[model samples]
Target: MKPKTYFLCTVVFLASVAADASLSLAFDKAKLDTFLTTNACKYCDLSEADLSGRELRGADLENAKLGSVKLSGADLSALPMEKRTKRTNLESANLRGADLTNANLANAAASGAYLREADLTGADLSGADLSSANLKDANLTDAKLDGAKLDGAKFCGTVMPDGSKNDEGCAP
Candidate 1:
């Protein structure tokens, strides 16, 4: 009821809010790391988290938001290529040594993502946007590219899904 008491209560409330926010951030970070290490968070909210070198084999990550997250060297082979939307959002994310065989990535956005030495065999990339993605030494054997956009997508020693080389403007 007193003015001094009210002021002290307000300060305490503000300090508590700040502390709560910090704690929440810390907890989210810790949880993310734990999930990556243990491979527990299959369908969790991993939006905007750093997941480089994570082993997500056979994980159910359907409809997961990974906008602007770093997933360099993350093993995504565990995902079932058929009957699933392995269509990940890896814009500017590192994808070295990743396996994306037979994945349905139709209409996915992967501009500027590093995909050196990655495998994309039999993947359905129809109508997908792969601008500026590094395909150095990557395999795309038998992958679908019908109506797909490949503006500036590098193809250094890349293998097409149809057992052919992926030169610029080559249609199946």
Candidate 2:
């Protein structure tokens, strides 16, 4: 890991430990509102939020913490061809243990993202950039992942896009 990333993770862990027990794991209401209104929330903490079935295509969420967030059936895919500017940026975002069942994440830029143990059953992740992402133990049954960038991605115990179990990146 990069030094910066390591530092950030350490800081976040320390902060979570130092904070009050109740508020540390909750999503920030103000940040959530900002993201809902603007569709852009870099480095925001949206973890543990219930955002199922929301229209969030092309949202810019780089480095955001979405761990344990309920995004089942949400649309976080690419925008239409004519009206498009950029793809959804999930780079380095934390999506660990998220519920993304049937979510549309097609063509999103998710390089270096963390998605450990996420439930992604039937999610559409076609053409997305997943380079160096950690998908350990993630469930991708029936997911559409054609043309996705899988370079350097970790997939230990991951349920593949084709509904197969993959232990390619597992450690002994």
Candidate 3:
């Protein structure tokens, strides 16, 4: 092979390896399994984990520390009645600044979660418990919140589920 062609090939190979290494460092199947089987992950750190676009239907993640976790476009929706073992748990998890756009989060237990500035546009949050969650400036445009608990939940500058903007939680 020509020297120039060999150098180009080597650079491309190095780049691909770097990409793969980064992805592998972000995802851990063992940790995921632990959360699935235990139903409890209090203070479990999953920061910067790339879980985007994953199908996590019926996953129980109650009290798991998911700070800065990338769950954008992921499916955390409820399963059918027959297939459901329990509701998904995300209660009190540090979901601050997470991207959940177009994600399905129906019936999730997310009370007291730190959802500040999270993107929830077009996401389904029907029947989810969001009581006392800090949802300040979170986008919920075209999102579904039918029967969801929003009492004491901060909504300042938040986009409502019906596409309306709210400033009730915004500071004066």
Give me the candidate number with maximum TM-score: 2
lDDT of each: 0.64, 0.93, 0.79
Name the regions of candidate 1 deviating beyond 4 angstroms: 1-88, 167-172
Give lDDT tens digits, candidate 3, residues 18-72: 9998766553667766765754455676666777898777666666667667888
TM-score of each candidate structure, all chains considered together = 0.49, 0.83, 0.72
After superposition, which runs of candidate 2 have C-alpha atoms over 4 Å from their true positions? 1-25, 81-84
Alpha carbon deviation, residue 68, candidate 3 (Å): 2.5
Ranking by TM-score: 2, 3, 1
Cα lDDT tens digits for candidate 1, 13-84: 999999988754422666576666765553345555655555555443433433334444555442446677
- What value of lDDT does candidate 2 attain over all alpha carbons? 0.93
The alpha-carbon lDDT assigned to residue 55 of candidate 2 equals 97
Q: Report how far off residue 140 is in candidate 3 (Å).
A: 0.8
The better-scoring model by lDDT among 1 and 2 is 2
Question: Which residue pairs show collisions in model 3?
Answer: 62-89, 156-169, 156-170
